[model samples]
Target chain A: MLGLSKKDTTFLLVVIFLTLATPILLQPFPESSALAQFNAGYPDLMQRFAIFGIFAIGFNILFGLTGYLSFGHAAFLGVGSYSVVWMYKLLNYNVVPGLVLAIIMSGLFALFIGYISLRRSGIYFSILTLAFAQMSFNLAYSVLTPLTNGETGLQVYNNDPQVLMSEGSPTSPHFFGIVMNEATKVDVGGWQFTFSNGYYFCAIIAIIVFYLSLRIFRSPFGIMLRAIKTNQTRMNYTGLNPRPYTLAAFVISGMYAGLAGGLLAAMDPLAGAERMQWTASGEVVLMTILGGAGTLMGPVLGAGFIKYFENIFSKINDNILHSWFSALPDGLEDFVVFVFHPFIGKGWNLTLGLLFMLVVIFLPGGLIEGGTRIWNAITGKNRKKKREDAAHHPKPTSHVN
Target chain B: MGILEVSNVNKRFGGLQALGNVNLDIAKGTVHAIIGPNGAGKSTLLNCLIGKLIPDTGTVMFNGISVLGRKPYEINQLGISRVFQTPEIFGNLTVFENMLIPCFAKRDGSFRMHALESIAAERDIIEKAEHMLAEVNMSDKRHMTASSLSRGDKRRLEMAMCLVQEPKLLLLDEPTAGMARADTNNTIDLLNQIHDSREITMVIIEHDMHVVFSLAKRITVLAQGTPLVEDTPDNIKGHPKVKEAYLGEAAA
Candidate 1:
């Protein structure tokens, strides 16, 4: 079963099926309906979802298994994007070399950062990683303007030497002869579904990365990482070095972020310094935690949830709210829209923050735990005891003995 | 020559001397106990031996290898396993998973990348872990999380974790520190059985006299920051120096 156990193989299959069917599933609203505005099946948004999903999945490998919460993972993402754009500038529009260079460069960056950051654990480790990322972000913004192109971002110019580019090939990123942005729209009845080449490409890579993550989670290396999370002292005393294992996990996770960043650049041939900002890093963390940090499907779900809300929720204006409540009394509808004003439209981030807090407070295991709880309740199983035990043991606490 | 040899070890914390000019030789395949009152440098000496703390001026030789500046994991790879005063099992993992960790370390050295191999396919390691759990009478609780176990059971699991490595030297720091009398006796019996069945050596630091006499063949008593006496358990039982150091009685 692809080197996975029976249960893991089944889980991977379900993930593959769902990812492949995302465009169809996400476009349930008919084109004529008002809810159609909420649909997320558009090519641009779908590509963003898949790319961020890859980022969240990679972050989970470190934070979920080893309990090493890296606060600077976005630096790798930015580095990856820069590498891909550079590849486009120097090589060709083909994404293979760009992606390969992105992964290699980010892996080396992760190795250097991980080597230094892993010397400390807990919050200090987080601070060290954050500092490194901030330094990178600042450097890319100002000092390394020639390399990163300062505020304008790094992109392929018309005059740049692309040695590998054939004379008649498209200047934009492509997979051989197929342009990444090419999309096909099929209209059935009132429903319109968009199938984008870029989204499909990102989705396929995301599925492969997700499957590899499943293998890593079930492997002996995954067990060792969990062991390090639970009791690092015991790990050391048990004849295992936690440092090298943690460093490896960190590097692998960084490569995942780099792959995501490369995919983003492939879809849009630009690399922004803002992508390396701490806020971008925080978004991935929020996604992983909101969806469930340790669980396999949590991060991707979290990524989709956040991205979907960012697209749909931000579109809600007072006028749209009024239109939805038009059937109600005029005064009541006005009051209703006023009441909802702070949580919708430009305030969508406020709504997201509130939801994130609720998840952290009530459902510490993220959305996955909430789903499990509901399932257990419906099945009439007394899972309270088990849930209590898990809550009692939260994350591993450090102690000197 | 003994399996572990410590000589002229001195350690200080600020103005207070934690360990002063300590020397010891632990013979192979024997149970040696190091006992002392509160703050008598018993733990400091143990720390020095296990690479947790480096003595100011001393030499620690394990199987003739100088263990001066080695990391804890490196020291563990040299076949010396230490059980902490508090049970330090992987709380988030199952008892069976906890057992498999040490077995893997023993088989695959300190670190190996097996990220794609399934645990179920490792038939030999799984069987070995299960057998070790049965020996510790924890086979029924193998699937239970380590943190959910009772205190005494956690101690047993920790012992099983250390034993799975099959180390040359086993260090126990207060193995029965907070156990009931019955549990203490059970631990003593378990230690005695393990000692009789294997060629392993043990050095335990304990406050329990009953545990000290039951399992320790050789005893080293420390007072202040240095070893006061080293002798057999019987000779150490009623030594006048030990009584005075313990009871603060003036020598008569």
Candidate 2:
């Protein structure tokens, strides 16, 4: 079963199926219709979904298993993007070198940060990581302007020497002859499907990273990380130093973030200091938590959910809201649109925050736990009994700890 | 020479001396108990011995190796294990997983990368953990989360976790500190069985006289951060100075 346990193989297969079918699944609305704005099958948004999914999945490996909440993961992501851009400038427009350099550079950066941050646990650890990230962001924005291009960001320019690329080749990132931004469009009876090479590239990497994360979640190393989360004192007395284990998990996650950052650059060919901001880091945290931090599929779902809202729901305006309520009386429709105005369109973050609060207050385990509970209730099974049964007979590939 | 030797140990906390001129020689293959009234530095001494605290001036030698400046995990690698006052099992992990941790430590040394190796495939370690669980009579509850176990069972699991490492020296800080009489007796029996069947040495800090007399071959009574008396359980039971410092009354 692909060198993984049966359950893991199944999970991977399901993810593959869903990822390949994303274009059809996301573009449910017919083109040129009023609801066409809801179509997430567009190349740019689809690429974002897969990229952020990688970011959130990596984050889960750290915060979920080790219980070390890092507020600076986006620093690694930024470093990764910056590294890939440098690779493009010095080497070539080939994504392979750029991505490889991104992962390596971010992994090294993470190693340095994790070494210092892991000396403290809990809130102090979070604060240390945040401070480091903030420091990196500030530096990249100002003092490191030559490297990061300051506020303008780092991007490929025509004057740069691309040693590996011959003259007259496309400047945009490509894998061999296939341009990343190139899309193949298919027209059905009423629906249109866009199959983007960039989206597929990001999707394949995301799935591979997800599978690696699945392996890590079931590995003995993962168990040790969970043990550290459970009781570090016990781990210490058991003759295991938790620092190395935590550091390893941190670096691995940072590399994943770097991969995501590389994919972002491969798609758009730009790197911004703003991507290293604390807000970006918090978004990944939110994605992991909103999905289910420790669950296998949770982070990806959360990433898609957040990205979907950010790209689609935020596009709604007062006119769109009024159109939905147009059937009502004029005055009532105005009032209804006004009441719902602050939660949609430019106020999508408000809705996200409220949803986050609800999940934290009621579903501490996040959306996956909520879904599991609903499933249990629908099946008429006792939740507690099911949990106990799961504890007793844990699935081979599903080691949440 | 004793397996563990502590000499001229001194520990201070600001204005107060927590331990002063403390010296102990614990022979191999014996259960030694250190008892004292509250604040007599019982735990402080245990901490110093287990590398949790660095004595101001002392030498702690275990199997002829100095343990004063080493980390706790390093000390544990030197074949010493400590059971805390409260059970310190990994509450989020299953009881069986809790037991396997020490086995991993023993086999893998302080640290090794065993990430890709599945626990199910590690037949030797799993067998050892399961057998240890069977010995502790916790095989049936091995699947339960460690936190869900009763206080007594947690202590048992903690002890099992330590024993599976086959540590040269076992340090217990009140092994049965908060347990019913029945559980206390059961713990005593378990300790007695372990002591009889293995060549391991144990150092226990306890306030309960019954547990001390039942398991300890030699006892040290501390008073005011110093040893008041050191003798066999029978001799210390009626000693006048021990009564004055610990019992606070003449023996009936």
Candidate 3:
């Protein structure tokens, strides 16, 4: 955390190695190892982890650093998604153009919103962003029909004149004269893994974005934003008007959101206005807060966690659970089904709500706290250094300490 | 030539006239203290100087440039830094990281936007920050998280943060408001050490008479949002008007 020293970086790399390698090692286990389902190994889910991880990380840059609680960040994400899809429809299917569109559009949107919302502080800022996002959502669904395609969403079908895929060719709008229609699947001895080239392509972008966020988190500007969150008045009195610094943070985060949204659209060449809906924005906020607001890897972990639950829970029904538990004792099977009842079927949201509540109430800092707790538990340095650190700095509860 | 000038400055906040036609001039390298009672517009004056508040009718000149309508970061870029009564710092950051901000501001101006390169890699800034920390006797606490510092140390760190910018003017409000006598003495000594050693122009707004008299080269007393008198510590302590307007029963 101290500008990430070489030694500190070494420690971080070790953690990353452990997390990434864990899923590969889980391949040998039974299809349902207690932890196998949560390992984030599947290609579709893994790709999502990277994209939404980028989304939540970008959100954290604004919400976590500047202490601005945004309920409409998803609008930027949805806009990015729409722009990328439109790019694929009109231009070549190369990801670069989509990425650029996402950043530019997201940045433009953030600048507009930040200019107005940053005028007020506390709850007013949150609601202003929410209002702007709602405005975007309403326009995308109706007013911006030509671009956003109303409620039907934007998708690539070889319609009219804008088909770059060359009449009956299987390659969906080739990238730079090279068509990447080849889908590769690798099975490490019966785990049944399928990976589209798009997933890894997005995976690398997510990693780069993740690393960039880490750098921003530790920079001088990051510190200034955090300070602004803690005490804008004091900062202003200290001869530092927080507006410009916060505005910088807001724009950077907006660009990140745009990038994530753009990547999502590029992967599938379909953009729905629903993606820009307020609910989608709320989902990213959920992911960020559930994972850990200010911590680096928390957003990634939270994104992975939420996506995994969405995939697994959305498909599982009472019959599927009953069929699996049919072999158990009559009483035990009924009890098991009953336990998963409120959270198993259309109750995925109930589960999410419970998880959010638990994380918020017990661990307000999110997964970051859990990680630090684990690290502290293992190192046994907590008790000794606790007093010392406490003695050293007053640590006013103004912001993200 | 006057390095920093404020002429005919007036500030009104709704119903209150916080500063009434006030004018101030701070020479290049002098310790200028602004002393007033609880509601004498001490903070209002500092706020106007830093562009946190726009004066109703006035002009602020810093380094021969107009500072009347500049942003706080822009004013800071003009080499005017400020420290608060309560320690204003980045709690999550280390003591060392807190000092790098002004270096970037001073060298790179208000908007550096340097996305790459670790802040620690800025060796020149680090060296200078280290020097400032040593000046405040806080070099040993470099690696400590700023959130973990004692009250006295937080003030020292805040002082060093302002100093590292090498500002022509440093504005401090209540630098020793809530400190114990020992800590206050420590703060006074630290301010003295910097005043004796550095080429900084400081304007301090303090409630504590001991801190004000100890460090101020010249002190300005404000009563009812107007400058009561400007004099040396000896002259201020004995002046009937200052004592009557400030130090009488209420100053006790």
Candidate 4:
């Protein structure tokens, strides 16, 4: 309850509504709407959003709460994806089996890497993680080619067995026991909206995972993790050995990443070594930092923001810009095109880099700050009423030990 | 077997000796106070016992088993708990949550890697934490964040944290080192009450003379790196050698 007040609960509900509804709201807009062309309600993009959202949130568990910056979180995610692909190749093409395999593999990998890397924390820890991630990437690209398919990655082919599901070869049909088709569409008032059955499936998984993470943040272990961030020596003197607790936290976060990775593969039966790249791992780090490291919903918001922009910004071209800017004066069109050309085309990465820097500087708390500010603005006028209620509320028992 | 025993312990940092040939034996359910000057090895001795530091030569035995080469958690599992000079409660945790962690330790032992279970539903742990909080008079502040507590209250919460584990021996380093005179007295009273009520052996490192005299049935005085003398409070207070070597020497 220390972390989850009544206000926070309300805030969480709002976030859940927004994320679940965003795809539908963004999908059906007429072409004239400002957000119509920029929308990423497409199956491929939305699935990526939910997957990376989970990844960023998982990384936040260690870095945000414990003040540990791990450069090798990508290793666990990569291991998870590879393990999931193997499960698909060996067992039935069921999402459930894939998920279990991913989690178990990622947890074990984290245990091994975390054991060694935890030996030296701070900068050394970061370096160790980076080294391990690179080692894993290299192995996936070379020695583990049979399983990982080397640089090209493992893709589902006609010869591959499709045991569990009918339509999606190598990807089992139902998710979390839900009939995917039933969960993906809704019809009302002469309007019909259909998203990828897989997208909604991952969305539900993301919600449940997010809830579990929230519970973790409010638990006793969560408290100790925060203490470790503040004063590890103090916790030790209080009869705690932080190493085990920290390791446990690390493993749990890794499992979450594994879950996300398996979901990624399940949504598309394709395992690419490129997804395991250090850059991909670093992407989640940027998302977590850009959104605000420690806040619960920051990662999700950060992930969505980055993914949406990455999808839209890269689609822009000189032709698209010129068509829109044709309505402008001829003289200013050249000046506008000069500035927009780089960002609208191959220079999307620069836009992301600049946005990340600006967010980290201006809104260090990320989307959570916006949420808090909105809450204050809405509730500020009712402060006296709230306090009055608080005063009359049942006092926590005053009995001394 | 002595419940807790330290034999001929020696510790050196560079050329400086922090503890030299020190020996101690503690039985169950007794309060033992360790008094010393600034450069005395009271803290160092404790650190070695808890496996935070390894002495140059010594073996620490807990309940007939040797405890050297084990981590602090391993030692804690053997029922040896420590409290620092500064209260070390998890600042973000509520007082009740601070109690819950040790209860988890007590119920699960040194390590139980059960990844997913409702820990509160653990009946034994719940009872123990509730009981310990009651013992320390902190049940009311159970839901208050540990960081929000006053200095004395923080110390109280830390003590509750250790008590829930039900250790055979509790090592406290300068429990009353920084406090108002009144708070210090309250802490002394609290310790006396806990020591009286529980079957726990205590080795407290205290700079406060009043606190030491109030609870230590047997006081061991140390100066530089050697034990000055081990005796009752009356004898320790009167001993000329102890006064010149520690009390007077330290204050000067």
On DockQ, the stronger of 1 and 2 is 1
TM-score of model number 2? 0.95
Off by over 4 Å in 3: A1-41, A92-96, A167-169, A173-182, A231-244, A323-332, A379-384, A387-401, B1-28, B36-48, B52-66, B246-252
A42-126: candidate 1 lDDT, tens digit per residue: 9999999999999999999999999999999999999999999999999999998999999999999999999999999989998
Model 1, which residues run further than 4 Å from truth?
A: A383-401, B250-252
**Candidate that scores best on TM-score:** 1
Candidate 3 local Cα displacement, residue A376, angstroms: 3.3
Better of 3 and 4 by DockQ: 3
Task: Please provide, for model 2 over A1-401, each residue's C-alpha lDDT reduced to its tens digit, 9 standing for 90 to 100.
Answer: 65587877887898999998999999999997988888999999999999999999999999989889999999999998998899899988889888999999999999999999999998899999999999999999999999999999999887898888887777798887679999999999789999999999999998888888887877678888889888999899999999899999999999999999888899988999999999998899899988988788888889998999998889999999988889999999999999999999889999889998888777777889889889988998886676666644533221222
Candidate 3 per-residue lDDT over residues A66-158, each given as its tens digit: 888887887888889888787777765766777788899899989989988899877888898889888888999999999888899887765
lDDT tens per residue, model 2, B33-78: 9999999999899999988899999899999999998999999999
Q: Residue B24 of model 3: what lDDT?
A: 80
As a TM-score, model 1 comes out at 0.96
Looking at candidate 2, what is the lDDT of residue B134? Answer: 96
Residue A262 miss distance in model 2 (angstroms): 1.0
For candidate 3, give the DockQ: 0.35
- State candidate 4's DockQ: 0.23
Better of 2 and 4 by TM-score: 2
- DockQ of predicted candidate 2: 0.56
Question: What is the Å distance of residue B162 in model 2 from its true position?
Answer: 0.5
